[model samples]
Target: MRSPADPARLATLLEHRAHRLRRDASAQAEQAAQRDREAQTLRSAADKRLQAAQLGEEHGLDRQRLFERLRGVAIARAHVLECELRAGHLQEQAGDAREQEQQLRHAAAGNHSRARRLQAVGAHIDQKHRQARLRRQERQIQEEYTCR
Candidate 1:
């Protein structure tokens, strides 16, 4: 029959899983940042469009030209709103990923602590066995001397 996996090995696996989770979380954060940048760009574009429309109105643009500028401004604002929504969604996803990563790291730390405890226990048992063996050997030598 196959032997069960040792605690040290299990701890190593847990560490690896934690590392992977952290990497995934970092990627998620990067994606969220990218989305934020895109949203900001869209917002800037909308602001510029609104400013141009305002300027045109102040300069006494004809009614038809003013209407067209207003329409463009409206469309730009809508795109900005959509981009902002997507950015917000990405930020939420990133936060969730970070939370998951933290949970996994905690679990991994617990596993590592258990593994260390098990290792200490194993070492203690080995030390006792060694001491017992030495005592037996010393007793045998004494008996041999007495018999001689």
Candidate 2:
């Protein structure tokens, strides 16, 4: 049988693992948030460009080339905005997945610790039973010798 200290060591190791997982998960979340903020800024810039383009297109009917240029600018901005949003969404998904993995790891540690505790309790009970039986046998021997 392993020493009582084994479980404590295992628990400490598991705790360290859990802490690392949590730290990594938090870092991923922070990175995702940064990406989201960046995407929002890009989206805002695209919206402004689109608004400016629309205004310029509506202001002058004679400037056909200017209107075309504005339309092109709006389209380019829209594409860039989509790309930024996609990056943010992908990063968010990655972060969420990492967090979920961390949660699973934490649950696994809890389960393992609980199972170990139960096993230790069972072993303790068995030891107590054996000692009780030995005591009973000694008492029976004494009683029999005295009766004789």
By TM-score, the best candidate is 1
Instruction: List, residue by residue over 1-148, the lDDT tens digit for candidate 1.
Output: 2135654455456566656755665675666567567656766775676566553426767899878877877876776677667666766765675666567566656756666676666567667779999999999999999999
- lDDT, candidates in the order shown: 0.66, 0.68
Q: Model 2, 37: alpha-carbon shift in Å?
A: 1.3
* Total clashing pairs in model 1: 0
Give candidate 1's whole-model lDDT: 0.66
TM-score of each: 0.69, 0.53
After aligning candidate 1 to the native by TM-score, how far in Å is the CA of 69 from where it should be?
0.4
Prediction 2 global C-alpha lDDT = 0.68
User: Model 2, range 1-148, lDDT digits (tens) per residue?
Assistant: 5566555455556666656666665676666677667667767676676666554425445678776776788786777678677766866776676677667567656756665775577677668879999999999999999999
By how many angstroms RMSD does model 1 differ from the true structure? 3.8
